[model samples]
Target: MALFLLICLVLTARLWSQDDPWDVASLRAIEDSATYAQQVGRADQIGFSLGQQPFIANVLIWDQEGTLLYPTSDGFTPIRYELTALRIKEIETSRASAERPFWAPFDHRATKLLTCLHEANICLIYRRAELEQELGLESDALAKVTEPDRTALLAVMSLAVVITGAALLWGLRPARPAPAAFELIADQFIARRGDLTVELTARDVAILDVLMKRDGAVVTKDDLYNVGWGRDFMPNSRALDQHMINLRQKLDPDKSRPHLIHTVRGIGYRLEV
Candidate 1:
């Protein structure tokens, strides 16, 4: 069961990892270039292309004066601006002075974009005018798409737990009861007297064979222990007590007053016909 749970957890982690689609450094680089393009008032003139074929999308550029420009989608448009050089210098200064790496602040943004790509299969476009509206819709769609089937997975795990528990229970079942030693010997004696009948477990028959061979004498705890449990000496005396109890129950007409096998206090038991 533990092994099964471990396997399930490993599979789940692999599935989640496979589903994760995003490269942080790549996204950060794209964002940085986009920021530079926007600050230089050339966002409309500049276009970002992705993939092998270089598919382009129209982007709205903003100048330092907050002036918006819209570029034609036909081709690249050159925008003349004196602040472009100053913007580059400012970016260099910002990079040098920044306490953390340039990509650190945008980690969450990159992760969100990656998740969107994995679930919604949508391209993230940072349009100046429609940014808010597109972002809201994209985030909502991504949330809906990425939501895993937790309820079904939990049910399956619960079922597995129940099955494992049941299997362990079945495997650990106790041994079945065996006939008493005295009853087995008595049955053998009766069988020799023109009545062939003996119904006893192998363990009970072995004990009976040992006692009958001794000819009704008292069998010490050690003697019974060796023959019954195959031990050199008495190990657990309670085992002998239980076996004797089973023997009395099977042989004695009134179990409350055992007649066939008699117990000697603090010593052992004797079998008498």
Candidate 2:
């Protein structure tokens, strides 16, 4: 289940990364509106129309020579702001070359708008922030995902988190319960719990016998070492630890808490059962 959600999340993020065509359509709408305004000589009114749009911070038109045409010197300084520059060069070039009806030159402002929109001579600029805010993007300056797409992406991420948590919980589930009764049959070198019985080596029997005799009392490692293997043949420090581990595994294979033997840090061991 977690793997499935992970795959879904990947696909969702991939799909959301694609550009929405509506952004292009919206820009075209603005272009078309500008074209109409220039044709009818309402060029000065273009700013008013643009200002009405929630996404338009400002509009600027620059000629091929980099000279500011619209929003003349009296309106704004020529310093460029962070902008989305849309170069209509080739597009305008092809359209301008097409045949047209005979007419006189346009009004000064209309000519400026015409030159910006229909000649291969100008670049249109808009504030980048306006475009981002209008399109619901925070960082990626281009390509936008709609509100629904954003919500779906968030939901996919949430599901991925939930699936991961469930996996962890399953891994941390409780250990199996220990048996009801347990005893060490020293004579037979065996450890028994209910119906289960485990055979033990002679050394394991000697160590366990010592722990049981001092039940609920901490038995020093030195005493256990001497008892299990006479002082003349004492093994390495790690030998005793390894033997104890093996004994614990044989006695309670389930390895539940509140074990029969407890290590008293640096001191020694204690027998609880």
Candidate 3:
């Protein structure tokens, strides 16, 4: 899951980088051109220039005459000569407007080429060099920008998760004690009377502790099977029963009515608290 999230973040960054060139400013210019064309009820040409040396020009020609000018290998060729003349006039008008030096909405040089004859033909041109320059500036800006190391962050996050998981496992581990006294061991027996001192192995202590937890409650054979041999189907459980019997003999003086360990008729056994 962590790796998946990391990959997703990296992919998102890559996509954002790819789209960084056509940023908000570029889209705004296109929108403004569309709005102007709609209001004037005539075809409009919008041009944008980019970069320090401004080499490229991008032109958009909108014609209401329903004429389609196909672009050739070299450049666009309009079928209607009148539409071409109108585009040239528009570009010239834009250039004559001295009130604004840089093109409004975009830095590229913009001018009205010509006036439309039937208010149907509009021609626009854009220099490709300007777009390249803009892209170059955007690339440079991206390069100069600093970002956190994704690999390093992922490594740190993975380590944190592993550490947290380990801590949780440790906290959930069963409590145990080091070898102490015989009575301390006997105290682990399910049924306790104040007198006996019992010697038991580590396995024996574990079994006694499990039984003690459910004192006076019937403990099934399957429960003993799991606790003693981790539910190993291959391991015989006779030894476990023998250990219980031995523990009973040690704790109960009268073995007939075993005070420590008692057998249930059809079930398993119980520890009398």
lDDT of each: 0.36, 0.46, 0.37
User: Model 2, 48: alpha-carbon shift in Å?
Assistant: 88
- Per-residue error for 181 in candidate 1, Å, reads 16
Better of 2 and 3 by lDDT: 2
Give me the displacement of residue 243 in model 3, in angstroms. 2.0
Q: Across residues 157-259, which tens digit of lDDT does each residue of candidate 3 receive?
A: 2111122322332343344332122223445433334544555666666666677676335566778767766865554557767877786776656543324
Kindly list the per-residue Cα lDDT of model 1 for residues 1-273, writing each as its tens digit.
323433444355344332221222123223433333433434332432221101111222333343334332233443221123333333233333333222111111221211111111111222221222333333322321122345443332211112232233234333333323333444444311112243556666666667666444446678778877886654897888998788556554344332556564444565544
TM-score of 1: 0.27
TM-score of each: 0.27, 0.34, 0.28
Q: Point to the candidate with the largest TM-score.
A: 2
Residue 208's lDDT in candidate 3: 67
Q: The CA-based lDDT of model 1 is what?
A: 0.36
Top lDDT: which candidate number?
2
**Can you give the lDDT of residue 34 in candidate 1?**
38
All candidates: CA RMSD (Å): 36.2, 32.3, 34.3
How would you encode candidate 2's per-residue C-alpha lDDT over 22-111 as one tens digit per residue? 233233323433443352223346444543442332344445564545545454332222222222232233223423211111111111
